[model samples]
Target: MAARPEPMTPTGGRLAIIAGGGRLPHHVAEAAREAGEDPFIIPLTGEADGDWTGFDHEPLFVGDFAGVTRAFRARGVDRVVLSGGVRRRPDWRGIRPTIPFLFRMPRVVSTLLKGGDDTVLKMVIDLIESAGARVVGVQDILPSLLAETGPIGAVSPDDAALADIRAASEAATALGRLDIGQGAIAVGGRVVALEGPEGTDAMLARVAGLKAEGRISARRRGVLVKLCKPQQDVRADLPSVGPATIENAHAAGLAGVVVEAGRALVLDRRAVIGTADRLGLFLAGIERETMA
Candidate 1:
């Protein structure tokens, strides 16, 4: 494993997390607190799943730009982090834009209707920055969560598994370049599945179904790979893996999983390692260029 990088010092002013579904926002909040900063959380309605009982938090809908801006300004927030999964986009008609933003509503609607995930995220970042807060990536707050180079757990990929990894990595990169998805699955050096809007979990489930039906070779194990988009902003939606990922990969009859080192987030690191080890699954962090 590569050595962990030193933690970054939090920039001046209060930190705010635009939290969505999952433990990631909570993790970021904990990291911010550990760094001697109290973080205010704006949990998206229906999207944020965890209890935010102890943290200073406010609930807002997905498209409440005016409310989010007001909350940031009220709490003297200058650094904002967007984390976790948003399963669905908000309805344009339901969005509450600020006066200035309202003027740009036409463009916003157009982008929402026609743009890919990357384009939509860039627009969101622009809107957040326009509200006078700097949008930061979860990586900026907790560098240790990033996958380091080499094996993440005890098991290591074999030659065939490594070949699968390389194949899936290339496929994932292409998928990302199209602003489509971040994950791909391969078996015996043949790409089998590419993640789409339904996400990695659903994609893996598809693979499992295919395997069960004797479509993909039941004899040969596969590998799953996740990578950053070629033109991604990186601050909003970096690929993430966790214990669930290991479980899913095992269920999918995969031999291993690989993610781009330093570019993907590994949630609940110890748990992920334990799960990977228990399941006898190889979890490696590879450099994309090295694999190429």
Candidate 2:
């Protein structure tokens, strides 16, 4: 077995969480607090959950680039974590760019218009780092959330399901290589669905529709595969799944879900496992080499 990477040590400085959406930001905050590091949350308005009352938090719009930088400097934050989801692109008209943003405005605009999601994310990371704060991956603070290799829950994929897993994985990786999306579904060794901008849930919903329409054989189940994009910056935007994912896969009549071990986040793992078990669905985490 390959050795797990060492957990990152807390910086001991105030940690700022650039909250987006979903339960991930909350998980990261709890993990940071448990590590004895003070956590300050800077939630992106509309995207972030409003349950961050106890922590030192401020709600700021995602377009407010100036405000975010100022918050980090004012709060004495040295380390930052960008967590959760942000489905909508920021409206540029609403933003009040800081001097740094202004200085890099040309490059930023060019990247936003011409580059893919990964390029845009890399630019965002560059912007944050240029502002004198270190951006850390969510896995660094919440290593336990990293999906473990092999099968999870009571159900395991059968040989046919495994074949579908491999097929779906190849499709998903091909999509990732193009910086398109991170998920794909396969039935009976044939690709059935590919995730687009609508995301995994929506992709599964489409598969469910196909299954209902008799396009897919009701007796033959499939697998959903999600993994990091090839050449993706691992420090941000790793693929994730939770209880809802399992429920959706079950609804779509998928036999299992496969993720990249040590590279994907398993949100609410206990609940996810329980749901998978109850639904008789397998959740497997395969190593990157297997996918390769």
Candidates in order have lDDT scores of: 0.92, 0.88
Q: How far is candidate 2 from the true structure (C-alpha RMSD, Å)?
A: 1.3
Q: For candidate 1, what is the lDDT?
A: 0.92
Return the lDDT, model 2, position 178: 94
Residue pair clashes in candidate 1: none
lDDT of 2 by residue, 168-238 (tens): 98998899999889999999999989998898999999999999999988799999999899899988999
Residue 290 C-alpha lDDT in model 1: 88
- Kindly give the stretch of ten consecutive residues in candidate 2 with the minimal lDDT sum: 1-10
Global lDDT for candidate 2?
0.88
Which parts of model 1 are misplaced by more than 4 Å?
1-5
Compared with the true structure, model 2 gives a TM-score of 0.96
Candidate 2: stretches off by over 4 Å = none
TM-score of each: 0.97, 0.96
- Per-residue lDDT tens digits for candidate 1, residues 114-209, read 988999999999999999999988888898899999998899999999889888988998999998999999998999999999999999999999
